[model samples]
Target: MIASWRPGREIRYHTSLNEALANPAPLVLALDGGVFPFRGALERLLSEVQKPGVSLAYSSYETDSGTVEALPFNGDITERFPFGPLRAYLSERLIPTGAERFRFAWEYHARLALEEQGLFPSAIPEPLYFHAPDLLPRPDLREYLDSRQCQSGPDLAESFAYLRYPPEADAEFREAFYAMLRRRGAFLEDLEPERTFPPGKGENEVMASVLIPVRNRESFIAQAIESALSQDFEDYEVIVVDNASEDRTRDVVRGFRDPRLRLIENPPGSIAFALNAGLRAARGKYILQLDSDDAYTPETVSRMVSFMEENLGCGLAISYYQLTDENMNPLPDGVVKHLEYDRNNILRCEGAGAVRCWRKEVLLEIGGFDEEFGNYGEDYDAVLKVSERYEVCRVHKVLYFYRRHQGSQDAVQSKAERLNAKTRIRLRALERRKKLVQNRGNKRNTEGA
Candidate 1:
């Protein structure tokens, strides 16, 4: 009879491979014999695979257990005895076999299968079976004890070579053998569905709308979404506009099914156009324009909303942002200056630099964004236009985290594009001021003369 299984306790039982095959709930295999021996290793391995979607598990072992004994499980014997039993339980299963001798067999079979089939199951670091030293066959005493004295030199040299130089020193050696096996076609099984979102009913009322325009960013998209959803501001909506991404960007966005998230597709347009699309659809009193690669702090939206509510005169408000690499580590001593946004300061310094949040009505009243500039300078242009009419405020805390990665528009855009766009807008505004000045000069001359 099988041992009773408890929720938090470990139970030990012996079963033939056939029995294990028939009962297919996830199993953790332990190797009780190898170079390393410990229960902690198995515990750690279990902890790693205990994540929602992963299966196939393992544990560490050492081969020098003080005694030898028979394989614990007994069952019906047939012509295909051990092989049939092994195949029944582990056949087509992508398991990480941990024995020294069996490692070669696993690697060889896995690689061959992968190369032939172009599909394989993952052999992750979980322990599903334990191989005890007592289970190993004893060396034949009668035929092997006296006949090995023929060549001590070559065998000694080979052993020394193996001891000194590990598997990596040989080019023909397989390093990621399991990976090779999975690639070939050894075990092409479907993984159980993994839950990506937190459990619970979602909030219905929208508090804030986060607009993100994505192009070809497939890697950083998920991280950005997680950061947004993780915000302390619960009543928020995330609007993602796909600007014709040729990568897995669509798939990544579709994976998130939060009630707060709404995905919109924009046909091959500029960043400004995509933002405008999201802006049109946004239902929040305030709109937060977050880059697809950037992330906000846990209290970003909440703090901004609270600050805006408390300070009624401020039409737009923004906090400082930390510049980080793709790995989310801060750049060395790299700090971006926070711009002061008083009326006098605005006149002297053009407009607020970098980041800013605005009232949705104010943003819309300023004609949303100048789509002519198309990309880089559009945010600055919109801020400049809005700042001319309303009070812009800068919060002193760092709430936004901007990622500096390759392929970012700021890194790749030409100086000419920025200069041309900025100069055109500035010149146009200057000409209007000049026309006003000329008209006033004419009026003063007529009145004085």
Candidate 2:
């Protein structure tokens, strides 16, 4: 029995539970016009519950989507509500102000109480409301809430406690609370860290091989290895091609001692030469080229592999990356944003080049790197060649960190060397484009004659 009623000016409520189940709307389904795609919310609610229990629901609505499900309420209301200090004050102070305020305050309190009681259902699994796209909070409601003062000491404590303590200390408090609950056997198994990687067997075919070409990256090499090994995606090997580093780079690689780490020695030379060596020895269906100083997010490989799998037509998948300083500190937001927007343009200007994860077969067919322009712009050259024949995708997530340090080749290289490398890259691009045009012209001439 779904019925929609408009209360006074801006408030509208659609109640369905009471009418549907005269016995007890085990699930109280509420809807407001502000929520969009209200139908999807209804469908999700119906799908989540196979068995019966008392369910109290509320939703945050968008202007376009009808309602976004808020926390589900099923268990003890008291424990879930007023469970937190901020909520307690809201219940104690805000509710007493007026009936109009009480309705809004009660809704907020009810949601919190439901969560604390372990009655809050996952809004993701079952959306009970849809929000309209352009939905905005009423100005009157906003003004009313803002005008109310938080009462005395309790209010001050709740507001300032978070600011006073460091996040780690707050985390410790939360951990202790959860630990206590765990001892009482109330902890959910899903809350535990999930192990996605399986133990290595005798001869498991590696799914991907990560080739990291390094020179004197002794400081961050370990971090790079750790990031790669810590990936959620297993079945991958890290091939560190050492370009004759005079530093303790060997010591750093040796310390890890993971079977998945394969150390290849490349005498002090070009980035292209070292990468080509790694490519020759790589034994994976897919290949990822990483810089020794760069670190990857745990989900980087997983996301790349998934993207590649889904998009069979694409030969390479490249993601936007963040630029970090020597110590791996991220650059300013404006700088990062600009770099991301310019990545495609940068790749195009250098020819058919882009940063990407490539199929090993496609890479091998391209005859590996040109070894001529060894260090500075070799990656650009290889990517240009690959992109000529294969479809390349640009994933707009910062999955990799391009670390900038004084010792980096980009910094140490002379202006002449940099200009030379850029020239080499442009020349290579022009050559490839010329060849393509000639082939097309030849074919057209033959067909016309």
Candidate 3:
């Protein structure tokens, strides 16, 4: 297919390696089974490619998920081809051509290596391409599980979407590859021995504590408070950290005559600050997260607490949640399977726990939530820390309700800010990996001497 915006241009065609070789043009472009609506995509891509030290070039594109995706390119993550349609390659480097520069397996690493041989890969800000994941038949968890292709930790492998391999690769190979990465310290690694909490049955001290951090969420605060108060796990305490709510949130919370509801007021600041305040005052061994605008089912606390108690190694636990509209109406099939535990890309772990419940001591040990991250993506950073140091578990039950409203950060954060925040998160993970590698080297040297 020819990538052109001019009138009467042939934008669609089927070609083989022979046809591409026959073409006299220096560059060959391939598009998914869709039309290229972006006009300057080709020009902009070529311009960047022609730069003195540029190798492969790509453009940011919008995904079917209503998010503008321009994932930060990394060699390790490239092997999985998570780029989806965000990238295009030098045709000669692809399969059946010269060196088979690109493939379903090693496209990212090979092209990135090719760039390293000369100039680096280049990117443009335009949404040059459109690719929908639904266009292809992807294997669901059932297919992966039934295939019996996952011999190594099939439980975790099948749970995550990206880990589900096609029939081409056997279970052993994928599992071995995963083990190698885990050993290399890039993927999920257990925290140092000293970091784990003591294993004693320290009082079922307060059983569980529900932390609700809010500011100006009057309309929703009462429902959230009641949800916490009505949990089947009666031993739990409800600690509401009020962030100077000007709305009727304070009055509504005060209206609750329940003695188990502990309300602490803090100055107007970041949500992290309120969370920290609530966490500091929590008396329970485990903490349940309750946003002012979202609620928990009565069974949520009990179910999540059981999961954590059963999985002693897990530091934090999250579960499937029902996504409802502002009016509590069912919103399509928004079932969350917690696919964030990719074991490869840490970024995918953002949803490690949409509704998080952490071991109080472990949460405190990790320094709790960083007030520096402000309110946006604060939980994500904390989850990443927990995942780095300890295992994160996902309960298959829909124990929580997430109401998608206009006030939520997911609905209000700008595209640029989302990208920027994700980029920062990625950098942090990378830095953590670097430190781990250095520490491993130091330990080896010490042992040798």
Candidate 4:
């Protein structure tokens, strides 16, 4: 319940978080169920919270496996609560009047907002507590979605607030989020019209190209290849760019005798490199994504291609996908569609969706995927790039199968690795959004003149 090296001071217990926040103490420590502070943990948190203008403070914590260093505070914290156990000193006077009416679901929601109110966060450089594995929250997509009490709205702000903290669907919170984004200059009134692509589609061009970037995914490569080859839509080539796989991944591609499936070998490099190489070789008007470890439904290519073809303004098309086991059995969550894919809020969430299809000419115009992202955030970077310049629409149908198995790249990433990747990606996106808002303002000014 307490650290061994605790400061010899009187401590009081409150029945709930609200009660603790209501206390008149200069500092308060809030811990998740079964969280045990390590030696000197409270001392560190207390020191941080006592600093002038500090609203909330946190230190890294240990789990069953290892210590998780908390991510450094940033604008990304607005949408995602990245801290674990934390200390707070946000008395009612410190918060803006009427802000309390929002009734945030977690103390984090209230504390994070204080940053905008001129308060700041502090972090200790090391682990301070032990988080019991059993007590940790593992929120499933389906369960979380079903539990959300918010209604659908055309405004991305409402959805953003709902998704960020589903338990508190306050209208005031949604408006606050919108105002925050507007203040950051990341608010967008509308997407720019589609930029004109180069003159014409190249000679002998296919309607679409299913691009598969692979490395040591021999087990799943064949199924992914088959899914692309068996698509209901014709006139599409399956371009499998092997990133110097040490396994039989290339050989499996060779077994598929379909001329429509072409395997391009590349020097061992990042997924971005492999994808750029495929993009260069692709002769399709549209480039569809098919990961080596994932498969698509027979109509995925058709649906995505049709949607893009019908809507010339759309530069990127994202379709819903079904979560499956390694053997391809459907997961309990079933279809995972991010209905929150507004052009503006694309900066808020993870991404549009899986089975993304891009306009080949638009991909060329944007210079393909940015190799700077290397492997981790190339797709996300691409999405952000495309969304900025043109409309990104969604298809409601389940067009892809996202497999949750050990071999999938995302399935094996450490929490720290994911956090680092996300931080970089989000920072880049935030900058891009600011620029978008700036450019829009400049354009309006010119038009007014």
Candidate 5:
């Protein structure tokens, strides 16, 4: 019996994608919730998928924000979901493996399976459907990982490469996944021995420098300074690199009477520029990150300093943080402890965490943060460079308060632009990692011969 009726076609709805793929229909159209097709959506998708070597086809869609262009498919769907509400697949191309276990993101898993088989999706650049604005969440790792108990054999192997193992993953599964990464040349087996710090021109007593870069954040600048000063650690200095603020941010920073707090005046420039200035003026052995609009926990400085001192091989470290509103009240799902963070999978993710601390020599050697990213992805660029050689470790405690307010940089930046900038960083990291792995293989071959 026909489960549902569509215009000029009978729709058989299956609970799982596996069942649908098992029974071949010449063409398959998958619609996400709240997706209303435009007049010619199906025709356009069908026309595109029928083309030679095209296994899947998808079109852009209209959202409350605007028309989201069908992002160019690069055959690597593991990094992100580029398709929108409407996706059409050639029935013969969809692999039944790994499709049944995914309660949510099943389509995503199917796309990954297709990608592994060298089947890439074709894109139609125009809007073909209306996607509900409220349906904004991408496939979540936790939601998919929860279904792991039901997965085994080929299904598990197909999904394993894209999975980020948090502490929540079973011990056996985590170990096996890590072993796979090592064999695939994606994982670094061990950290390099500790390197010597750059020689100091003069004697400096500061062990850590809490670097705060500001532009027009007068309201919260004082709180940030206060929190830094409140640190239990004594051998640390607080350096505020003021980026020619039009507001009273400079005045508030000057009001601080502590000798350890110093403000450096800089011309209007990118956040990276301000940060580089802070790095130059910093007298501490380690540079700690503290945004002008965010405050650190009292133990933040002490904990980070101790970790860096104890772990000689670690060049950079980031601590977990609490996501709060401007009033410091915790937002829903506020505690951001990125337990899924692994050095091997850093290429596939965003930055590790906030309250990042880096060895001064390591920052200098990597030429500091890349100013090309402007304010958007400087931290991630730096993180990628540092992690390539030295260890990038995590401090498991929440030692910073990340306040989300209208005045925040992320709040003001265009979402599309920010996403584009981050995607560029990820692509660059991918190339760099590929080169590194290739070099390692060549070296091993030479040594064996």
Candidate 6:
């Protein structure tokens, strides 16, 4: 076996395959700790590795909960290491899976590194290992991007190598990575219609309470208010929580004499706090959010309500939205159309559109928009929390207009602050997932003898 000369740190991963490469061992079976390989699992893996181009092989396994995660190998998803630890590898084809130097991402990067070199991992569609999935989420590019080193070079090349990205795409990769980083600040449409409510719902009760948390939005407040007032649905109210606006925002909202409109004088502070105030005052079964600077179409609320009504299990609903300038001129095409709720992709980008609606009960359960997240990331945090336990539906129609003006939060947020916010949100999401798993385990145990 080729022993590694890696010094300074002791992480328990093989540094290089050179030792295994030099040894006569034809096949190496890799299994994660706490995972039990079933009989013939190694043999089945071996049988596949003997075939051409099958550099690495992993098999489906039953999680501790008794359900199997029989995932097909997608080269892209290797970033998350969906291929759990029950695997077999050909000795000669082994790449530097990663050394003990950087403990976390090397494992996932190894999968990607191997794939970049045409080592497509072929999957064995049989249950091989018995283990529970890790409660922690896989490391994302943020792992690489969030390194606190003061860059001594124009680009992060050496760190890229450490992260196992191919050197050729450094410039292009930095651009793409930065592009996604820039987008972390954008809040997109991530909702629904219809007429039906649950059996106990009162006919006179508000169907949906559209909450607009506003502060100093004189220019766009009228448009937003008009949009809410114009919704075609029956039995809905608009609560414009004026967060101590210095401008004519209060005046603008007061100008509207609609009986359904209510104004709350919430002193300026956090948007989360404002949202909570609105929630406390909201009189509807469903709570929908509208930014002070954004607006909805006449049918946006109706459509969102209908969707949530039909998909009773969905705790939240967001729809597609068109990005336009302040004047409502449509932005050019190629904007990231957040059409689906890909769990991993959504983490990297807020593919969930901006216009969001939640079940009032669910909102209260999660403590109403997480006041800790404050200005930028509250919605994302809320979306993820509900999504982990309950389904989050995506409405295919663009029933909301996300205005991109000079005053837009994304445009105004400083780069360092944005990065810092995202870092915290990602960590919190992981921590939340871990707690969720623990909670599930505890519930199941309590229900047992």
Query: lDDT winner among the candidates?
Result: 5
Q: lDDT score, residue 299, model 5?
A: 94
Candidate 4 lDDT over 246-358, as tens digits, reads 99998988999888989899999988999999999998999999888899988988898888877778888899999999899999968889886676666656677888999
RMSD of each: 27.0, 22.4, 10.5, 8.7, 8.4, 17.0
Please give each candidate's TM-score. 0.50, 0.51, 0.72, 0.82, 0.80, 0.58
Clashes of each: 25, 32, 4, 0, 0, 17
Clashing pairs in 3: 93-101, 94-100, 94-101, 149-171
lDDT per residue as tens, model 3, 215-288: 99888888898888887877689999998988888888889998999889889998899999988998888988
Off by over 4 Å in 3: 1-25, 30-44, 55-185, 188-205, 339-343, 441-449
* Selected candidate, larger lDDT, 3 vs 5: 5
State the TM-score for model 6: 0.58
Worst 10 residues of 1 by lDDT: 77-86
Give the CA lDDT, 0 to 100, for residue 153 in model 6: 15
Report, for every candidate in turn, its global Cα lDDT versus the true structure: 0.54, 0.54, 0.64, 0.71, 0.73, 0.65
> Which ranges in model 6 have alpha carbons more than 4 Å from their true place?
1-200, 334-336, 343-345, 438-449
lDDT (tens digit, per residue) of candidate 1 on 1-449: 11111224543333333333234434433221211212343344445345433332222221233222212111111011111000111222334332123322333343333323333222222322222323334454212212332111111111111122244422222333333323422211222211121222234435578888889889888888888888887777889999999999989999998988888988999999999999999887778878888888888888887777666666678788888998889888655554534432232233364346767777887788789977876776776565555556777778878899887887788654554565566545434434544565687799999
Candidate order (TM-score): 4, 5, 3, 6, 2, 1
- Residue 1's lDDT within candidate 4 is 13
- What C-alpha lDDT, on a 0 to 100 scale, does residue 283 get in candidate 2? 78
Choose 2 or 5, whichever is better by lDDT.
Answer: 5
> Quick one: RMSD of model 5?
8.4
